[model samples]
Target chain A: MSAKTWLPLLALAALTGCRQDMHDPPRYRAQGSSDFFSDGRVNRPVVEGTVARGQLRADTKFYQGREGGEFVKTLPVELTKDLVKRGQERYNIYCSPCHGMVGDGEGMVVQRGFRHPPSFHLERMRELPVGHYYDVITNGFGAMSSYASRIPVKDRWAIVAYVRALQLSQNATMQDVPEAERGKLSQEGRQ
Target chain B: MSQIFHPSANTIAKVSIFGAIFFAGGLLVILNEVNRSPYVTRVGVAREQPVPFSHKHHVGGIGIDCRYCHTAVETSSAAGIPPTETCMSCHSQIWADSPMLEPVRASFRTDRSIEWTRVHDLPGFVYFDHSIHLKKGVGCVTCHGRVDQMPLMYQQNTLNMEWCLDCHRAPEKYVRPREEVFRMDYRPQESQQVIGARLVKEYKIRKLTDCSVCHR
Candidate 1:
């Protein structure tokens, strides 16, 4: 062959040799079948009672939202300003899409046409224990899906605190606010 | 031998062969350049969808939050596309009879999803989690551009590996306060480097260049 023809051929040969096909071996992809296992699945069962790193949920009250087979009335986490702020942020991101910013059940999503969630201001909702909110978020209710996969456990309690705050904001009398803070409501002529 | 070979004809043949080779090489180079251009890549091109949803009207004019429609952005790997019910919620009251929203109404009635053409598509090999990015305070505008300004959504960034690596190598530069993640118009009051350094420490963001970080 001519040198010109051979030169292109040589370049092609060099390029072909650099293929990554060998690096990507024929292997079982995630959740793929494997005849080597008796169950014909590549995924191994989580060994008997082994807990995953950083996933030990020994505290039934915090992790499960329940104690003694009943939902707890109060939050397990300390209700700090930062924690409530975090809850507000998380609520706006996750719950506000459906539950509205003030928990009025008139969120943009509901206004747009999805099923309206019950208002937090309702006597029944206000009377419900705080753990009920966490339980609902963890397991989902009616049309809503479980938020457990998205929100961390600590954040879930934080959200519960915010929900309680929302319930109070909606149902509060003038006495609920401090004397100094009451002036802000009167300034808006809402008092 | 003299009769069998004509010098002038041989010269013409050699010149033509060389010309053909050069032409072919030039054509290949031009083709490669064209493929990489914005026109071919559809970088700013507004892709046609089943319905002509205007981000300018929804986001800019009305000031709807990004989370209103993309509900699963904070928790799911994929940013959840709004179901048809979300559209009908408003359209059923406002543009009840507009032909433009017929697809939405039909999808709502049939319980079928509207097949929205994906704009920011990554390659199959790359694994991107929207939840992780949102949790890490990477604002929607960082990768999606100023969507509020777009009349019709388009692929703002190239979304290539190089583009991803630019931020992955130094996440602090793009990190913002979690509260500001959804604020489309938010601008850093301080210099990005200064704010980013603080956010990097606060958020505990590590500069990740590992191939498996994305490739897996």
Candidate 2:
């Protein structure tokens, strides 16, 4: 072919060839592998005894759900409607599959043959301190994996608060409802 | 000179001029199509992973939320891949003995990362953040397509610059309610224009087509 024909073809080849270099620059992507690492992972493990900035987690009551040796009876964080709502959202995402939406242990995963967890309404579960639930979520309970990596500290507390709400909802009586809201419940029941 | 060129040479030259115009145009058209073709873009091609995880079975059949495994979608640049522990969270009890899940068990026991095949990889230059898009009410289905129905994960749309620009130019065309961002089967109740425009204003989603907006 003449130079006229070769020029256009050469330009096309240059365009396609140079693209690959830019497309995959010498950089690490999230969850990508690295040839330099023995494990072929780009992420390096955190060194022992060293914590990243803003991750000191010094508050034992909030972080560990324990003030001393004993589990705290009440939530360390202030209880708010938003906090419970946040907890409900996080619980549905991380815990509800196995623990059930209402904490009855009849979740979809439970129905699929996973071990049934105890109902929150049980006397034993109801009697347990709020911190006990936080410990179970931070560290795995029997047949359950630790959701610490999946759920953050505040959200874990949120899930604990929501679990409390679910327990109350299941075991509450007419007297438990507020005087103003009692009318709504009675009307709905009558209908 | 008894005609230095043949009488037909004039006709040949005329035909060549017209043919050159058509040939150049046709080449450009063919090149454009080839660039968008699956062979180049890998769209709709399901990648082979170490384990054949099915989003359909997990998300559709079981009705598990996307955030159940992808825990960082709402908070980070990368929609974090679930660790093997997430797999064992259910498989340890459900499919405890299946050969299909042996890789998962091995990974969990050995404490090695499961090398899942990466799909929907954009060029390194494009800094895409899943959190921002989701926060601004771009539903997962809008870009990822119907992942709940996909048995094996695949790239649903061409991760092309033009494709990105399509939404960047007018995000109102695709924005949904923030609550519906993770919902896979979400359909707009009203016309997309009405809902999207309302969401665009409510969410304060800007037409962020600046070069540094993504390039940086």
Candidate 3:
């Protein structure tokens, strides 16, 4: 063939040769659909009456937030400063959208028109047991939806601890402050 | 023979020989550019999704944290896409009557996937872990490019291997404090080199450039 005829054809072939066969090999990725499965999902739901490794739920107080058909009054895990701090971070992410930073039910979501969750400082809310908060977080209450899928067992307890801290902070008095911390508070107040 | 080559034919032959070199060079340059352009990479191009979910409205306007919906970002290889229930958690009441959210509601009621178009799909050969990157003090804005500013999700960067190497080769150029990893509006107080170098040491971030590190 003449050079005039072949040169443009060569350039066109080179440009169009970028087939993405290697870029997307026939395989399932996370959350991808599959025709091999009847459900059209790559993930198969766990079969009934079978528990996966390390997934036994023997502790009702920890997992169910209840003991002997009643809500437990205390946390199943140890309360520590680190746990509360972790809860603070998780709370600001998960719950604070609808529950407010201080748990006053005035969160941005509520401001944008979601139903108002009651204030944590209310007498009825303050009187509720610690497990009640955990239950609500796990199973949800009223306008709230279950956060079980989003929050794990331990993180739910941590958020419960932080909610208690927020409740206490709202009603704390001068005498509630430690003797050493009292001077610091007064100094900061003066400044 | 009556002169097979005319006198003007010599001039044509010389010009064509010189033109071929320039043509070949220009073709190579154009091919290289086409490989990187948005037409090929889909970078900065927002695709049509089943629902027009706005990251700007949720993240920038409402101030919801990234982890609010993407709960597994810090712990899993895949940053989990929130299930339909996560949308209805607020939308059940927030915009319950809006026609725009009918797809979300239908997905929830029918137990079907929303089938959102994947914006940042990497080739199967390249392995990426969101947890590891966030653990090493890489901010969400580093790869996602200020998601709060995006009205609809788009691939923010070219996501080419060369772009990956740009950071892997010198992580001290982008590493921030671990606490600031989730902050969308995070700006370094001092120079990035100063902050990144200190955090790189503090976080024990290694400059991983091995082929197996990503390819495996």
Highest lDDT among the candidates is held by which one? 3
lDDT (Cα, 0-100) at A6 in candidate 3:
100
Q: What is the lDDT of candidate 3?
A: 0.92
Q: Model 2, stretches more than 4 Å misplaced?
A: A1-17, B1-5
Query: CAPRI verdict on model 1?
Result: incorrect
TM-score of each: 0.62, 0.94, 0.94
lDDT of 2 at B126: 90
Could you tell me the TM-score of candidate 2?
A: 0.94
lDDT at residue A137 of model 2 (Cα atoms): 92
Interface RMSD of each: 8.2, 0.9, 1.1
What DockQ does model 3 achieve? Answer: 0.70
Local distance difference test scores for all models? 0.81, 0.91, 0.92
**Steric overlap count per candidate:** 1, 0, 0
TM-score of 1: 0.62
**Model 1: how far is B155 from its true place, Å?**
0.3
Q: Which tens-of-lDDT digit does each residue in A54-103 have in candidate 3? A: 87897999999899989999999999999999889889899999889999
Candidate 2 lDDT, tens digit per residue, A61-126? 999999887899999999999999999998898888888989999999999999999999999999
